[model samples]
Target: ERRFSVDLVGEVVRNFTLTLWNTYAFLVSYANLDGWQPAAGGSPAAPAALTDLDRWILSELHTLVGSVTAAFEGYDVTGATRPIERFVYDLSNWYVRRSRRRFWKSGAGPDKQAAYATLHECLLTLSKLLAPSMPFVADAIYRNLAGAQQPESVHLADWPAAEAARIDPALNHDMQIVQRLVSLGHSARQRSKLKVRQPLPEAAFWAGADAAGVIARHGALIADELNVKQVRLLNSDLEAVAYELHALPRELGQKYGSRLPAVRDALAALDAATAARTLLAGQPLALQVDGMALELLPTEVEVRLQARSGFAVAAEGGLVAALVTDLTPELVREGLAREVVRRVQELRKSSGFQISDRIRVRFQASAQIAQAIAEHHDYIAGETLAVALQAGAVSADAWLIDAESLAVQIELAG
Candidate 1:
């Protein structure tokens, strides 16, 4: 086994680097832009003021603290380090990535304040937890997030204690189900060669009774992540897929010889649902084919559920998720608009504009792309923080999105 290989070391470094840059540094920069400062007490907002996402991450944080504390107390350094690494990944990838809109929304309110407070609390606690293992990096993060709120050095700060009152096991379980469903949904999309940016009509998940509440609470997040208009809870897997009887040509050919074709036809004609149930119940299928009675063993026929038309599906551990892949004309146009927003945002970054900088955009695009821009003008402009969008001549740095040439130029709004 290559468990301790250099590749593992590289992966560890990459994970830490991504967490630090995307989560820690990015949040710090945004805080500065918003003129936000951490509270001296370093307390999170009241539960009622926080969103489900905020509560979920905070719950995860306390859980991590408890596990790390127990591991360190028992001298299990590896156990302690493993949880810390995983927490950082979740903090960056899920929490921060998902809360970006909350942070970016204009003006100040309880929601925005709660988002900042929750994130600050998480970072402050993490700095303290990492102090023993990573003294220098921990100190840097502590100084950046805590400022004058806490001890100057992370090493001087008290070890973080788990807040048991904040930990909700039920919420954690629901979030786990939601994450797994999202993962399965993404896999289905990939299998269908569908891009994440392409807007779809609906996605459905069936993970038994336990997931009912989970879907009700977190379905919006799923729809947003999967780029679907709606998230539907499937009552049964049958709604998303159809089980059909497939006769094994080789096995049936040996048994029935010249009657094999007729046998296949008979199996195909049988009510697939009834035949599947009968076969699964360990009974052979009784069929009348060409005036000959046929008894097909379970091994002679394969039962498989075909994904419903217009859906790409994936299943695991009795859970099934399906993504509707059919694209309507409106959906296609909306997807194009999303692509335009992505390109413009990329150009803004590459052009070195500040995050708060309002921009004016001009573009020359194919007819289809132009039509998308015209139809979704407000959405494209609002998303990109663009003051105006005008049709004009474009420069050489053109982008190709969905096989359509789009050339855009952006400047700071006057």
Candidate 2:
């Protein structure tokens, strides 16, 4: 309990502080330069077009507003705190993390503008929602985000009203499915000893019929999050999975008191594979025992899934993910490119380069690393904001980064 408290407090402080500060920096750096404000008249127009991610976040925000408001009105402090905590988590980890590139891109296109507006709105709303729980931090956020044009204090501002029309249950459901698959993918990678930095060819998800379409719709998002080349929603992959069913003796015995042994024998004789598959497919398993017909419900049996060889599997609450462990030459090259980018970024930070500073990169490395850089030259250059990338000796002033059997040097371009 003590450790749990410490961890939760640390997570809240780290995530909330960094994310809020970053949001303030973004608004000051980008939106202010564009003369944008969160006030009613001065704010940028609502995005004419919203991505699926955008809509999902908006819906989640609406839900948060309703939940928090109801909790406060009912005098339930813990309930109110829970919603605020969850919203902060999703806003920082999911929304901000995924949409960072949009905010960082140089130009102020429609997409960038929409991203800025959406984040601004979210931050402002969060200020009001959090004011009652965290007065000082909430007030600071509200003032920085809204004080310039609106209320002088967050406490003086009216509570944000939830928008019912913006809520989309279908989109929220799909996003939840995507989140689950991404989590399972992380577990599979851990089990296989594969770092997320190393790219994989594919990850497979076995979704029920009701959720298969939803999972397929967000295949690209899942693939990117998992750092895999592709995502396959394998509705039929269950054939490769084996399942075992254990009859709950207590529950079965309660129903068949005198005939418990007979019922147990009938269950033991049932075709395990067929029964497993039938139950997994959400169909009832029927049995003809002692001249009586009976159908088995899920509660009467416990199911366990076993994966075949060559796959890393993780499952929870009826959802399963099977990640392919085989890595190809092309995938390895891409993985190396990613590693190079990571190293260069680290060098930039260590060398005290500004976030907006463009630089020239120079490297002398092994033949394999050289090939990877050459093949993915454009990607490396764009990601690091490099004006030039070349292969050769490192300059005396450049920062040197060494990896296993690979070395590279980078310097800020004048």
Off by over 4 Å in 1: 2-5, 243-305
Q: How do the residues 1-414 of candidate 2 rate in per-residue lDDT, one tens digit apiece?
A: 364687887787786766666665766776765665554633533657567777788889888899899999999988987777677678777887888788767776777777777778788888898899889988987887784557899999999888899889889888887888899889988877888888887788876776678766888888889998888776565644677778788988798788877776787798776676667656677977899998877778777767777677776556678887787877777888888899889889999987778999888777767888889999899899899988877644432323534556777788
Best by lDDT: 1
The reply for model 2, stretches above 4 Å from the true place, is 1-12, 15-45, 243-310, 395-404
lDDT of 1 at 246: 86
lDDT of 2: 0.77
lDDT of each: 0.86, 0.77
Query: For each predicted model, how many residue pairs clash, with residues at least 3 apart or on different chains?
Result: 0, 0
In model 1, which residue pairs have backbone atoms overlapping below 3 Å? none
